[model samples]
Target: MSSPVPPQHARPKRAMAVVWASAAFVAVSAAVIIVHLAGAPSGAVEPSSYAASNAAPGAPQTVAVGPSSSPAAKPSATSPSAAVTKTAAAPPQEPPKAGWIPVDQAAWQAQVAAFKARKIDPVPAGVGNLPEFRADCQYSHRLADDPIVFPDMPGASHMHSFVGNKAVDAHTKAGDLTKFTATTCKPVVDHSAYWVPTLYDAASGKPVETTGFRVYYRSVRNNSTGIMPIPTGLRMIAGDAKKKVPTPRGAQGQFYCAFYGPGDLDGIARSTNGNWPICGGDATLHFMLQFPDCWDGKHLDSPNHKDHVAYGSDKGCPADHPVRIPALTFDIQYGVKGTTQGYYLSSDTTGRSASSMHGDAFLMWDSDAMNKRTKDCIAQRRTCDNNGYLH
Candidate 1:
């Protein structure tokens, strides 16, 4: 110690060196802190992977960034502002795609007015007698779908034989019909769709589809006055699909034999179960279903799918259903002489008879064609063929 006391300047130099080292250490620590700040967001908690994925499209994510570490600085799990933002970002709930929904009154009324503007005249006297027009269709496809009854729900119904409007299915809507022009029916103007329960041979469990399907639009009453054209989206169902009672030879609405030449309309013999007819000679099995001719002038459809329509009497339509429309008839024919084991409709849960045979019709036609045909053929009491021309 005594020897060091002789060099005071040397002691000062050593002290200066210690100060420089301290400054360097402080500078290096500051640089490290700056680099960390630049790399990542400050005061941000990592967001959950699920929350990021489930955020509504185009919705802004809430991110908190600040120096404070207090709970108030963070977003609350159930904050009112957050709830409002989420609700606003979500899309509105949509109504069911298909059902017995009400028709657009304003739109339908516009269609009615437009139809009335199209003027048409009656045919010459004695040119035709019956008030009818027809659409001849071939079988297009078969499926367990019913657009009228079980719309928007695929495979919800029993198997059905379809005709007209080839693209029809359980998802079909009334307005979507015209877009599909490819149809099985002639007179391409008729874009309507029809379906019936599939007929299956009970013996072999095989399907027997329709050989010919003729849809006849006619005036049931002799008085054709006030017979307005069928509404564009009219849907009607004929016969009760749930009717399980035996359809004997004499039963009403039973299948019968049809032929061009001499033969009984009820067939010469009956099936083993007496539900179906055994055609004789050149005849074939045929079923005729007639829908109502009067409408309520309000609903395009009803809860039961038949309440909006009513059968008019010989005099005129009823008071409730005042609007008179064409009576729709499904004249369906099936080839095959008659099997001993008979046949069963797809809707026949009883596995016994053809009493469950029923028909569904969804009407769609070119507005001009429908209005003209209704005026010239139906209103005039004249028969029109498949081409909507007098024969």
Candidate 2:
């Protein structure tokens, strides 16, 4: 009845609408439940069903978890320990000592003391012939009437002739032999001896006495040809000699004051110019001392030698004797040997041919003679020239 209705079709449509509405409602509820579960904070209890499925009792819980508010914190694994540990600093090292010490220091002092205790026997004094020959004696090319130019001796002959002729003429004119005696020979001046005390430690500031002392000399000849020949001598004198005599390793002192040369002859000539006109040429008779330990021309194993004086055209001989002229140069050496406290004096000339024509003498002296001569010179303020005798 009810309008006989649209029949069963309209009723079925209404029933379908109601079923769709119910399905939609169920879907909306499911979505709401999922969002709530996702939004919940950590450590917060979930609904009963979710808590039972995903969480366990006594576990770490989070509440209201959100985006991190600050940077992640570091763990405590790398933290410093409660107890403190410290290390001490190392000490500095010392510098090394120098090798050379002052002569007054320990090692040098001991050496000097030992040297003083060792007694040296006295040596005999006598005239001795030099076993070697002489050379470097001749007239310079520039000099007139080159006196050294003998047929056999090329260099030394002129020097010999000059000296011999002057000596003979001087004696003849003076009419007295006493003035020309060996003792009358003049001493050389302007000579020096360097003393380098051997120190125990050469580098130290302390002073140490030397174990012994040494005597050194240099003989040089210059020619117009621009050639210069220098020879050197070294002598070791032990400190054990008499207290009056220089001790080998004792304090610094100079034994020989004068270094004789041809120039002295010039002074003598000037003094006696009225007597001998050619006396100036005789100055070559002056000789220098050479020690035994010196370097011989024939020997190569000798110590190295050097000269502080230089060679030049203007560098004239100390006596104003002609430097251009060749000279029969002689050097002397004095020292102690073995256990002898006395001096060992030796002479060396230029070469054999030169010395043979112009002979040279070598002499040894006892302490008495040495002291007497040295004292005599000191008293007179004159230089001691002669070692012993003239060859």
Candidate 3:
């Protein structure tokens, strides 16, 4: 009887069936929040898989994307990556380079034993073993054709940097650099090839290689003249484009502003007006060109590669350019940073005034390593560096 009294319309039909099941669970939770706000983005999580792709001719119904948890990501051979790691190439150590760090290792071996104890004391025209040898080449790149001032324009000239010929320029013709045979130079007997003038900041055209090259094949008179081997379609022209001559110092087109490490750490050496200084904080920028050890023995190139070459005076090669080989000194080095408001010479292509700016050399070597570094380092006067050993 008591139970029957509880049926007050069955409690209003069970409260109208709990208000229609709470309005059908708020309409299925607002349709699952509108399908998760119309399918993700910024809540990011779209990886369930979809196929049928290959469009880019009219690209449309696509489905190809994956790879970017980012770890040097590189996926996409039509997608197949696990966050790239690859790794392998690394075994050519020798330099603080590759973003540069250099500065220790006993101060770069005491700036290379004070550049091998520099000494040219009264050795300027006797013509043999004067500086004997030194061909260090390292820095490289820069161009502006100069087969003696654009011998058929191969870029015209003014931004030099050619170390040991990667096939130099200006319409190259030391017979197109005699059959290549790979070289960057280092006792392969003197692979010949060197260049300069290119240390930028010139209001930021940005350029600054050359931090190694000290090809100083000497003979400033002793045996007066005993070296040979440049003759192979030889062509020349050294410094004086207008004259920002990096380190030339006389007896023939000289200039200087020196200094390169070991008085403390990065021994500051700069006065460069055109040798274009900007060193340490990240050092770089150097030059010291010098050529012309007379040589009119018989032309191999001369349309003005300095008219058959001449400039060994102090009483020597003037007997009508008689002959006295080996005389080149080009010590360049530039990694550059900061300071700069001066520098020129891509052979001053007509803008001259880094003192007339100049530099052009083309002597295609490798001819058995330039006749075995002219019969073993300047005819045995020895002291190699251009790779003929003995250094």
Candidate 4:
């Protein structure tokens, strides 16, 4: 009993030791749990990985596409609903073909504006000592859904739209075609037929149309080029029928443009199929083809239609094609409000090639008109039209 009384202070020390041992065991267990979590499989995660903040919320997330120069593709709240929404960077304009001119956008626009502003009356004013004679022809019909060279065959030739002469067909003759017939041209003297490709809707696989069409025949010569009539049986091709002939930039005779729509005049500017303005909407795509002024009297048609005809220069006609005639011009207009899918040429029978993209003219002028044109208007070097004598 005396020994127990003496050990009272010692009892407190033993109890304190037990408490320290329990605290150490609990600390070891917590560290093991931390290590286990750090090396755990995919599902387990450490608490430190995420923020445990109880503060206010921050900014929202945003996605930036590229460097600052290029704008974001999405349309803004204030932008036009019909505007072309940029989805990606635009590809560079195609490289101009060799010997081909590039399209001069600004110059083209200015020229188009000027043409639109021109005041052309049904009757024209004449110049003193110069009789004005022009063949202002409008759109009429398909010259040949088949070609004159190969008629009655489905796949042999390209399709062409014809105007001026009403009797044109796959086997029309100069003598017969020249017979006096009603025409869409002014002065009623132009019985000759003009032809080009007919436009088809790129989307619906149907035909497209034009409300306006006019062609002008004139002398655009620099030197005193002698004038002559288009030989009785002349058959020729203008523009490239085979090659992807690149038109030179700023050239007047051959041109490309957008009209009567949005900025692209509402047509396709760069289409997948290389049509400059791929029309998916309300704009119209246009092309103007100018023909040669010099000719070789002996040959009416060439194996290559272009070989017999030559363009005039400042000096005069070339030796090969010396007979000069008024340069033929086809001002073609099409109503194609298209989209960006692609476009097909009126002459395009083969979907893969632009070889069919061409124009053709068959010489069948009314005898009186031809005679008067060669003698008075062309021979006199005066500018003329179907409306009346114009300077």
Candidate 5:
């Protein structure tokens, strides 16, 4: 080396060039390895078998690579994200349908025809059971067509009574007649204070006597058609002193008068035994205009009348006394099986009032007849009888 003591400048320049070349080679090798591990670009590097060199103490560090670095090492459809997508895309199911049908018209007409074949009868002349009155009775197509026609009746002028007894004019004077008569009348022959009589007295105007007339009646209507039967009842009351009478209670009064008829049948007087007016005094007679049957068997012993009326001579009459009668009508129709529900007569299209009156004064069917009708109705599907007691 001493013998070759060439120029100092040339020696230093050679050493510098070598150092620069070494640094470039190290940087290039590092870039090649990094590119290979990252899935080398198409023209970046060639596949080769070589071991990586050790980095210098102060050289930059890098992450190590393994066989898992291959591009095909991706997740499959069984992944969590895929499962969530499938679940979100699914839809819910629906429920099944139900079937129903409407009632037929021909069936209803047939029922009406059958009812016409089995007609109703008029009320009897004396006190007795309702079923027995059917022997001598006439049938009418409709309530309006009934032969019994009321005169001087409150709602008769307004055509209210024609519909039923609901539309009676409450503001008129005749209207009061119906109200006073319907009240204070007892429907049953009970020995209670519910039955009050009428008499003229010297003081306190006209006082109602404890013992009087006992009347019972029943009426019915079809809510769907507005058709109904005549109202009817039987009357039993104390007689006057002008004739000899019998009293079970041994009271001073006698039992002379007794009469029964339809709503239009008026001026019914007792002429056989003595001069006894069938319906007289300051009282006006009325039947159980309309009533509903107890389907639940709850009201087996209930009265047929809706309420009682007080007929006073002061309103516009010859007598100066107070009397009681039965008023109010109702419309009743078949309901659900085992149900006692029904409609009221006041709700009919005819309208209702205190003075309103009903047509066709025939007697109501007794318990036996009602039971038979109910059974037949159930068989025809016109009504429901759950207990089978109607049969």
Candidate 6:
């Protein structure tokens, strides 16, 4: 009977074989999982590595994770094992050299190249008649600092009222302004820093800070032709800080009265010293200072800080300062009404005259923005407000 077909038990043997095979597969999968857990890379960064330990108190806490903050870089296409090559960063720039310093050749060349490439647009039809653009700024801070005059020496200079760039300090340079983009001025692209000697209340001997400050960039001459943009890193001082002369009612560069409508620019009453104006009826103290509109096309600054610029004539700029630039005017208004007791300037503590009133401008701008405004508004002889828009 063919040995009774091996006792007819094939089903039991097949079941045992299937059980053994399933056990072996489970063991292999477990081994694989253990290996992966032991050898896999951990991508967690150390907590201290990303901490903003150096941030100042009350400042926004910011961590600099560098390029890794972006999407993870992919491997090189040419060689999968190789990392993607990073672009070399530009070299660190030096802090701008101040008095008696010449402009950096490379930086000047780059600015000139960009300025030359800028488009010179014609005056648009129905443009306003004023050849001016303005930067309206609020008072930023008060410090015993003058960056242009007393750089790198904190508290060495007299008290000054600063506007425009909020980061300006005694150690600040033109290049520093760009790095600190927080500013008090509108159209924040104008990173320029402006400062004037602090005004003081004569009666109380307390500070009298500016209530309103407007910086006007314009052409003094009727003809705006051949006007080049103000060079980057230019330092200018408008009035004579050392002057202590009497500013009578009709004296030039004297502080005058400015009101809304139908009022005399000269005040109705004079100070006890006849140096300052006592305004009446809805008027306050106002002072307007105009800077030179001509540049030498050479030095960024000189020992005197005034040699690199010159006043322009009705015809054009002088030969010495052949390059024509937009004149900067500080239209400052004080909130306190003038009194017969008068006011004192930080520069003229003894004399207490407005004659010593002066201003300093350290210019830094977004090159493209400045070029556009110069071409579209200033060169075109159009009036533009804080936003560089015609009213």
Q: Name the TM-score of candidate 2.
A: 0.15
Better of 1 and 5 by lDDT: 1
- Give the per-residue lDDT digits (tens) of candidate 2, residues 197-261: 11111122111221111111112211123211222111121111112222122112112111112
Once model 2 is optimally superposed onto the true structure by TM-score, how far is the C-alpha of residue 71 displaced, in angstroms? Answer: 99
- Please write out the lDDT profile of model 5 over residues 250-300, one tens digit for every residue: 112211111212211122343232211233332222221122211211111
Error of 3 at 99 (Å): 35
Off by over 4 Å in 2: 1-314, 318-320, 331-336, 343-391
For TM-score, candidate 5 versus 6, the one ahead is 6
List runs of model 1 lying over 4 Å from the truth: 1-100, 121-126
Worst 10 residues of 1 by lDDT: 1-10
Estimate, for each residue in 1-391, the C-alpha lDDT of model 1 and write its tens digit: 0010110001112111111111111112222222322333121111111100012223342211111122343222232212112111222243234445566778767767866786666354334455667787877766666777766655566667888776676678776677655677877899998989878777766668788776777775647878788878889887777778887776655676655444565668888888877877766676766677789888888877878887666678889999898877676768776877778887783546876778899999987788888877787776666655453
Q: Name the candidate that leads on lDDT.
A: 6
In model 5, where do residues sit more than 4 Å from their true spots? 1-204, 207-391
Q: Model 5 reaches what TM-score against the true structure?
A: 0.17
Candidate 6, residues 231-250, lDDT tens digits: the string is: 77889887787788888777
Candidate 5 minimal-lDDT segment of 10 residues:
132-141
Candidate 1 clashes: the total is 0
- Best-first order by lDDT: 6, 1, 4, 3, 5, 2
Clash counts for all predictions: 0, 51, 36, 23, 25, 0
- Model 6, backbone clash pairs (residues 3+ apart or across chains), number: 0
TM-score of 6: 0.73
lDDT of 2 at 109: 38
As for model 3, its CA RMSD to the true structure in angstroms is: 36.0
Off by over 4 Å in 4: 1-132, 143-147, 151-155, 244-255, 258-268, 272-274, 278-283, 349-356, 374-381
